[model samples]
Target: MFRSLWFDGRLRAVLAQVLIACGFAGVVGWLFWNARHNLMQRGIAMGFDFLGEAARFPISEHLLAYQPTDSYGRAFAVGLANTLYISLLVIVVSTVLGFLLALARRSRHPLVAAAATVYLEAIRNTPLVVQLLFWYSVVTLNLPAPRQALEPLPGVFLSVRGLFFPSVSWTGDLVPLAWAAGAAVVLLGARFVYKRRHRAAGARGWPWLALAAGLLLWGAWQGQVGLQSQAPVLRGLNFLGGASFTPEFSALLLGLTLYSAAFSGEIIRSGIAAVPRGQWEAARSLGLRPWTTLRWVVVPQALRIIVPPMTSQYLSIIKNTTLALAVGYPDLSFVITTTINQTGQAIEGIAILMAVYLSISLSVSLFMNLYNRRINRTQRP
Candidate 1:
């Protein structure tokens, strides 16, 4: 009976899986034991109590007011915010820039295509760190001093120090407009749902151009009620009242965006190209203009292909934000490393960093997986 079970393919597969799991568990157990023994021998403690200790160093820019006297917990929060800020900016900007690059590469004109190819190659071939340094060492360095900073538009200044732009000052009156904005968004979403469900029954084909005009008019009308612009005025050696992005941040953001944009463009280009050429021909035969055909026929089909890989790009940008340390921007990694150096709690600090990054990655992956599943179901005939 034992020999019969061993010889059966199903039984063999189950046994193989069990053996592999046991081996993995054993190795992990051994590693944990070894690490604990080593820590005991070295008389080093491992705990997160240091998180509440005072952080005696300063951060250049933080979303919240932080002092050298603030606890490491607060300091870490600052770093986390900074990392998310940069990562979010990079993800949005890179995706937009990448789509434009892909479109440029798909251009019928050879000049436009050639320009895009050169851009893709140049950014992709170079090391990201080098690109970051170039922006910091070369681009920012060559900018005029604060006194002579360029103000091409009122309230926006560009200097070697960095970009200084007007910051929004909100008033109580904007609350009603904010509520209206939410309602408008909900209405638009409902319209999309209605349109999709009755796509075949749509007798009133609202022209895309008219829809665009209506949206613009609505936005303009809304803006008149509560929106206002405040421009920065140059004062002292630096702009005091405006929101600022330090040179290091600007460099890191630009470098990361341009670098990742190359890959994003390639991913999208392949996705778009994978759509059968006959699909485009069919849309054209149905009397659709280029933009209309692309919007209605091409993008919907291309989204299924594009979204899976785009998730990876989004995660990559999140991870790549750690490279901010190279340019003297204190992201989460930078803060954790500094904590380790200051307190000699290497194990604890490293553990915290790993946990935070893992959490971020898993959260992003979960959201993307859900989105991918929804797309797959919708695409099914």
Candidate 2:
């Protein structure tokens, strides 16, 4: 039996793979040991113990409350929150802008198509870092100061400081507001499930939107959710009261959105083009309007083709957020850099950064893959 196993091609292949794996593991172990030994000889501790120590650094733009006295872990969390906030904003805004750009390019009008083509070419050809620097300069140098801010709307101000807009403040019982939000989620979930169950009929989005709006109104009437919009006012040297986007954040977001939108538009346009011409003809023959046909027939089918490539685009967007440091936006990478400089725990800091990014990329891939499967299954006969 042993002689036969050794001679078998399949068994030999398995043995080869096992040996390669063991060799790779051994090399990794040796490298890790060598690094640790070197660090010890230099009288430097190599571990995650630095994470518990006080960061003693200030993060200029953080979603979470943080202080210099906060632990390194808390500082990391703040930085992570900022990174996620910008990334999500870029993803959402870029996707919508991209879809619109795609539609514009596909438009029969010569002028519209030409304009979109020019925009796409300009953005796609230029380096993103250069574009970011340009935006940063524009925001910080070209824009007027707070006292002379541009008021594009009733409650919006644009200035060197940032974009300030009226923001809603909820001033009511938290429990009822939570209940209302939960109910809205359940309604949306039910709509999703119903569409999944009945693929042919699918779902109409307006009904769900109306339901959520009605819930909000009902909550307002019952005093369960009291929302007041606070507008920014010039106070001292800056705008105060309403929510504001720092100049760094505004420039970074704008740069990312415009840069990514170009690629996303091309991806969407290609997907739309990939849809069989017969499908469009069939919808038109059924007396459906062009917009209706695109919405009900083409876009849904195009989504299957669009999703996979779009996943890579999204991952790119997440990774590109590391450039936020260039414009002084305090993203995770920025925090990591500061942490390394202050704590001198370069290895641990870098390891943490790698793990965070890897986890995020994997999560995005997993979600997109599942969505892709669902779309494929839905279209299957």
Candidate 3:
């Protein structure tokens, strides 16, 4: 009977999965019951109804309009947005910087290679919080006042408060809409033409240039160009009207990006190195130039190795955004912490925070997995 059951592959698989699920459910059920009993004995409520209660605390850096009288749910939303914003910013910056550093490590120049190595080592070895504090408190705070701010360009300023640049105000709807539509059309056309030409011979760089120029010209012709800048203007002992970047956000973003980039640089370096030397030789034998070999041959092979590990690093960056609490950044964790303390609803606050992070992480994983599958499908047999 055992042999017969084993021979029935579907039945055997189903039995195994069911047994494993039962064991997992039993463990989870026991934990839940034990926790509930403990809470009851201590006279502590364990439900999530407290999330509806008013959060009687001030949030300093709300992206949305929020007041102390706002509900706990609004506070949770504010926190989640801030966390996501910082994570997104840091990921973009770190990926760009890390890729550059990785390329630098592979440079023919000895000095460039040494410099890249040193940077990688220093950043990886330092504690992230310490680096954040140093950048925020020691570096940014020590900069000159607003009146004496660095003005490298007209209407743009950099100071201890934050970097300020002119922002465009959209007045006319049709002009801006038309410009956007035209730009999209140009970009799509350029991409199509470039891909067609590239598959044929790969010797045309003008399509991209033409697309960019066309977009710029179209946007300029539209009445969509307007500039206004209000850098920190000192009034007595304080500044006004300028976009103020809180030290918390600056520190959190800097720390996460710098720390994450170190690992990313190493990942990239390893990925590039993992591309076999024989592949390099093969490319050269095909009469490809050195630059073309790297661009078309080595890098593509390296990307397959690079992407999986890079996805993990990206996830780490997202999770580390929660560390904003340490530096008093009003990220999700900090908001949730404050909410819990004010409302005495620890369970609800913690649950919401966990759910938000889980959702964000799952979304990122889903996107990356889709891209990974596409890449895998395109790989040479």
Count clashing pairs, candidate 1.
1
Query: What is candidate 2's TM-score against the reference?
Result: 0.90
Q: Candidate 1 lDDT, tens digit per residue, 1-381? A: 998988999989998999999999999889878887888888876678988999999898888789999999999999999988999899889999988898899999999999999999999999888888888885467999889998878778899889889877654455455655566666666667777887745545465435645655565465554444566677788778758889989899889999999999988888888889999999999999989988888877888899999999899899998889889998989988888899888878888888998999999999999988887785445
Cα lDDT of model 2 by residue, 269-319, tens digit: 999999999999999999999999999999999999999999999999999
Q: Please report, in order, the local distance difference test score of every candidate based on alpha carbons.
A: 0.85, 0.93, 0.78
Q: Per-residue lDDT for 242-310 in model 3, tens only?
A: 565665676677778888888888898898899999999999999999889989998888888888888
**Which candidate order results from sorting by TM-score in descending order?**
2, 1, 3
Best by lDDT: 2
lDDT of 1 at 132: 89
Candidate 2 global Cα RMSD: 3.2
> Lowest-scoring 10 consecutive residues by lDDT in candidate 1?
200-209
Note the residue pairs that clash in candidate 1: 155-232
Residue 43's lDDT within candidate 2 is: 85
| Stretches of candidate 3 exceeding 4 Å from the true structure | 1-13, 41-43, 147-158, 173-232, 278-293, 379-381
Span of ten consecutive residues with least summed lDDT in model 3: 165-174
